[model samples]
Target: MTDYAFSSVNQLANDFKDAIKNADDDQKKVLKKAQAKFSLIERNYQIITNLYNNNMVDEQRPLYFFPSSQRLVAGKEEKGNAKLIVPFEFVGKKLYYGLTATGTHDLNPMPFNPRYPMVGLHANALNTILDNKLIHEVSKAWVVLIIIILGVVLAFGIPSLSPVQGGATIGGLLIGYTYLCFWLFSSQHIWLDLFGPAITMAVGYLGITIYNYIQEEKNKQFLKESFGTYVSPELIDQMYESGEEPSLGGEEGYHTAFFTDIQSFSAFSEKLSATDLVSLLNEYLTDMTDVLLDNKGTLDKYIGDAIVAFYGAPIEIENHELWACKTAIIMQDNLELLRQKWQSEGDRWPEIVHHMQNRIGINTGQMVTGNMGSASRMNYTMMGDTVNLAARLEASAKQYGIYIQIADTTYQPVKDQIVIRDLDFVRVMGKTEPAQVYELISETGQEPELYKKILPAFHEALALYRNQEWNNAIEAFKASDELEDMFPGRKTNPSRIYIPRCEHYRDNSPGDDWDGAWTLTSK
Candidate 1:
């Protein structure tokens, strides 16, 4: 049988070679001659023709030699192309098929026949192309499997995960899929679609990622629009990070309450036109509010020309009282600068604008701090006696002609850091507790020369006044009042406020029950 096969192969091969050489690479002529030669071969031996010069046999339909008609015919288009990388090995002195260990199959179809070497080379190239087409067709099922796998996993998975997690999942899937395809092709001669599944995963991840990013930005914008004017930016960010909205609730905590009002806001309203008043208030409030936020205080609300804010709610500071005091001082200094600027702007503003004065009152104690008001319209604010006292202190500051007044509770924590003078011991309206009050002058090392000069005399006068030494206190207060004129910008002093009070007490004594705590009769 082997001998017959060789004889037939030799005869047919010789005819095909002659036909090929004569045709001089004309594919049609070669195919025509191949068909005639192939007719004499056994029925089982079929001729596979690669009609296209390129090795991709499956790109277009393959062509075949029909021995019965001695013609080449094109086959139906298939799923894959003929471009496989066939494996090989060497055994003994001959090259064999690398798929088997025993070297049972030869690399060339006719290994021993050397007369038609060109025929063997052509046969090997055609065999490789055919092998590639077979492998490609075989892998179609796997291609569908991968597409379904990636489509199902990524489509369902990406939406449930955060952007970072989604990206990681897509990357992991791509890496795993790539490795799988590479292993199958290199080790098992399987081909799988690489770009199709990868594209699916990337598109799914990107679509979800873009959606998530937009949602986050929208949430951030909402928070900014809702709370940007009232809450500090840092507090707003903290609220956002916590992923919870401010709800209606209250909790008691030790905090500092702040209240500020223009010294004569009503007068200004009466003096300037409505437009001019709003413009001035806008400028003044903007600058002062900037100073308030810079010091980490949360703005509670703006009641006309009055500003209400607090420290140690939603977030806490180590020493909230100290921060509240510092904020007050900075605001006053800022107002002074505004006053100077308004004064320099000529007569655009009334004389009061040139010396624009504001009063700030700060008190520290247990207070209820949280989102307050009806559910439909709520705000973050403070309530209780501490809050009331702060408001009262702000109103009463004008009585002493002082710009800043802090309760003794607020003064103690910041005593060493701030420069202050004892103002009075008084029970503000709506409260029975007679709290000691102090004037917040300046920072510790930054006190003015006049303040340093007047502090001693003022403090002595306060001690005597509190001790009920009314006649002596009056003398001390008068002496301190005299020192105010020595300063260049000698405005009214708190000492001048005390001198009259001491004179009243000396003339009309409050019986022995007077605890030296002056009780306020008005709000």
Candidate 2:
């Protein structure tokens, strides 16, 4: 019976071998076709990489194939029992598969066993499982969708919530989810999508946080750019640290306004080439702006050769008028030094021989001050009659031949620190009320006695004029003008034009209710 069984098994084994041969032939044909297709695909990938000058790793190339072989082995004890084993290798990696079969004819593909004393079969099964897992994990759209959702939720939700609350929630969720997934995957051999969702969420949160931090820095940069030009660096630093932003509209405030312009800048500019002209102007503006900023003033704007600036707005300053007056004196002193330097440079210097003479006017009043302009653009500035009056005072400096003049209101506060002469009390070209103009003659150290002598007499003359004593007032002014001439190198020469105007006003008596104020007809 056993012999008969052996014969039967042998016949079955032979038939099964024939079947395997036939299957092998069919598989060979299929492999040849697959190889051709894979070769074409690999060539195409190489062509693309070459065109782009890309040096990609060989493993990264997508075209790949697996070559496998199977065999049947008969067992010694049982007639019909035999073993089937399949082996596979790819890219230098080995794979193996093995299973028990009743006969070669009944042999079939089977699940792998790692400890079945068949290394090739074990390796083949492992490779198959790994490949299937990779493909399945990558191809599933639901996994990708979940990753995207998690990324979105992390990015948008984290920053919006309080830091404490958001961080705790995210930390707990990540820990619990990761633990659960790992437990399931390691113990039950179940694969879960881990890398995509976790990586996406982490990157999204980090990206959003970094982006917000960058935006905050940009805002700080913008603030520095906008206001740094006007205010002091210390003040700007304070503003930035305080986290308060400047408004784009004007606010009413009590401020000390200062205006300055180069005397006869037009004729001087016309003499130089455009490049030299710009350079010269820039030098003067830069020097003056430095002085203004040092004194904590807000530079409003530059009107041609003029600089209009103010103090005690955007930020409050206690002694704004004093600072403004000090700035003017410093500017005048600095100009003298600059002029000497230019003169020493000799003929190479431009023919326009400018002496760095400046006319400065200051006034203290309630004015509108802020950044004002269209939605797209704006500038820190001041507006109102006080600003206009300050400008008019600068213009009037040419008539008085003075370096600096201040409205009576502006001078009233800082009169002790400065030596000033009451130059005039007349209605400016655009105003009905009389504004007393004072010449800022000197500071404490320089020309104190001369300023003292000149200012008293000048004030007496102004008092005479205001009291309607014409003849005596004219005599006082003539005396004052003479005294100014005696000090030959005085910063500003007294205007002869004013002598005539004062004489005319004295000769013709203004109306009875006249407050001894002269009217101006032109700007």
Query: What do the candidate models score in CA lDDT, each in turn?
Result: 0.77, 0.72
In angstroms, the error of model 2 at 455 is 1.6
- List all candidate RMSDs to the true structure: 14.4, 20.1
- Quick one: RMSD of model 2? 20.1
Off by over 4 Å in 1: 1-169, 188-192, 232-245, 248-254, 313-319, 366-371, 374-376, 485-492, 503-516
lDDT of 1 at 166: 72
Task: Tell me the tens digit of each residue's lDDT in model 1 across 368-397.
Answer: 987788969888788999899999999888
- Stretches of candidate 2 exceeding 4 Å from the true structure: 1-218, 350-354, 443-449, 485-498
- Candidate 1 lDDT trough over 10 residues, lowest sum: 82-91
For model 1, state the Cα shift of residue 113 in Å: 28
